[model samples]
Target: MTRLIKYAFLMSAAIALTACNETLEDIAPKAERQLPSRVVQTMKAKGMSKTSPVMMRIFKEEGKLEVWKAKQNGRYDVIASYDICKWSGQLGPKFTEGDRQAPEGFYTVRPGQMNPKSSYYLAFNIGFPNAYDQANGRTGKHLMVHGACSSAGCYSMTDEQISEIYAFARDSFKGGQREFQVQAFPFRMTAENMARYRNDPNYDFWKMLKVGYDHFELTKVPPKVDVCGKRYVFNSEPANGGKFSPAASCPPMSQPESLLTAYKQHQAKYDFAFNAALKKQSSSKQSETIAGHSEARLVADWSKRRARGEKVSRLPPNIPSPTAVAEAPEAAPTPAVAATASAYTAEPASRLQTALEAVAGEQQEETTTAATETPAAGTVPSPAPRPNTSPERTASVPAPEAGSQGTSLRRRIQNLFSR
Candidate 1:
């Protein structure tokens, strides 16, 4: 009976082992499976590896780069966020080349900026003096990010560290996202950062760039840089290869026609509104003097126009002579009986009339109030005088004139309105 029981136990154990192998088949790795061809094509276009979708982010100041993807509910599930084994310089806007400062702007990674054989693990350069930079007279070059724990102005990730970042970028870019923007800010572009170094030596330049940078952070697209001179000029459109493309080196020449086109369009809208309002005002009366009733009516009409977002082409053509609106006249009850007329003194009735007339020009009120407000920071108020109606000033805000290679904002506005 004992021998039979031992034989029975051994058979039962063998049967249990075979059943476990079948149940674990789903967890086993597939050695022969391959990625679909469509995925392969996309990976090639975005310069990604064949294994996964690219999804990554980098914060240079914090020395962290992360990879993540969305969960079923659309929240990000981080695959990784790691500390840099090596990095260089404090975070700030790199102005001149070789300032040993990491740039604070939007950038991307390209195959060219990347070096597979870089002594560090992998590497790429943050190309500065981009088209936008050149238009603003920003000069800089050769800002790089690399691997193997080494840095000058570049970010160095260990070979293993960057592999994850590279994989994420490659996969994300390949997944139908044309361009991924990398925002590198000085620690953070917080109110604290601005206050801490409001008087730093580089404050002015940083502040100026901050305007454009903030706009980009908010809008994701670059702000229109308005360089003013005889002719307003602008930088070229951002190139596709992040910071390191040859496209950065050969910024497209500014085409006056294109810029003028945009200006003309904006102007046409303004002109239409101005003409309509002027016609309405003219129809009120042909008299040189305006009445109090007419003044109140005009203000109501202007309020309506403002509600609709219409800009006045010009300030109510400076009242050649200003006037005040007439006040309600008081009257006494009819005289009960005819009384002897009393002698009346004839004071300077004309002077009183002149003063009363000055009160009737309602349009002047808005102009007077606007004049008293403080000018925006960094802007010098233009001398008070007849509003500048010069065709150039009236047509568009004047900006720096572009050389053969630069485009001017003024030109764009002109072109837009002219059309």
Candidate 2:
């Protein structure tokens, strides 16, 4: 009887241990994920640490996302550049709940917003519909920069790329930085691009963004962002100790005299550059205009282009391009052609050449782009094609008053500070 009881007890204990083992969860050790060694070496070389505060900038048109880390001097330096895997929507601010538009503006990310166990791998919310957006009555939720090469009104990055990015943010938070800033723009706010996009419906909004952009360009530091009168105000203080109200009229604002002087100097230079860019764009458009060309002449030119190895329309200008199976659909541009185009990408490209590149998929050898220009970000290379980046059922967003009121008020402030 004693032996039987002992055997029964042993069997029960064995069964209990097996049940416990089966019920235990298997978890991914994500929080402790470390930064890549190469990035660590780069930080060391750049006089930075893993714990330094970080900022991010995204250029939609350029398809670039840059990580800038603060150095000992408090100046930020570009530490990494990653091509956005995908971002949905047109090049504008998101307005509605289901627009599928990746937003463009400054956003903040706090520790609580980071999700290590994200369904899409790791992810972080870029607090959208901010004060300015709210003032303008915009609505959206859960916009994120996350892993998984997918986008649905979010900025998607590759798993490997996001691992490094997440590590950077995690390390910064660990070092006591409260939050980080993300500056998302349609493209690099360079004068040339500004001139190119001047006629766009979003110009006024872009102009407002430029003030904050210019502040950072001139100061090498993130501007203090505030929303007032339903617009973004950068690096300014209340003149009479009043507060800024997003909907109501703005209080009188002021800036440091020295900063104003610097801005005046900067603005003078930018104005000159902007005018030149505008003139160039106008001239290029005029030269490329095909509105008045005779069909015969267009056909003749088209023939010559086809002879020059250009993929051209069978019919004349304004006619639909060749869709009928004429020549096996020209089997995905040859490697040689792609290599040639990429090799000369560091050179400047004109609007016409850019159009041709688009038609030829930027993988063709023949193009007359521009003289010379640097990639938008340091060490950035030509952008790779991203999937699911096409705009979907996009609705027209109402232009914000920031383009007008903000412009006039910003100039008024500039004028005020100059004195």
What TM-score fits each model? 0.36, 0.65
Please list the residue runs of candidate 1 whose C-alpha ends up more than 4 Å from where it truly belongs after superposition: 1-61, 66-80, 136-141, 208-419
Best by lDDT: 2
Q: Candidate 2 residues 1-419, lDDT tens each?
A: 99999999867876776777831112236655788788899999998999999999999998999999998889999999999999999898999999999999999999999998898889999999889999999999999999998999999999888888998999999999999999999998888999888889999999999999998888878889999999999989998779999898889999888778998999999999999998888887764454223322433343344444654322211332122222324443344433433453221223223333343432222123322333555677677535322132011112224436445434432222122
Off by over 4 Å in 2: 1-28, 290-419
Tens digit of lDDT per residue, candidate 1, span 365-386? 5447766776989999878756
Highest TM-score: which candidate? 2
lDDT of 2 at 237: 95
* TM-score of candidate 2 relative to the true fold: 0.65
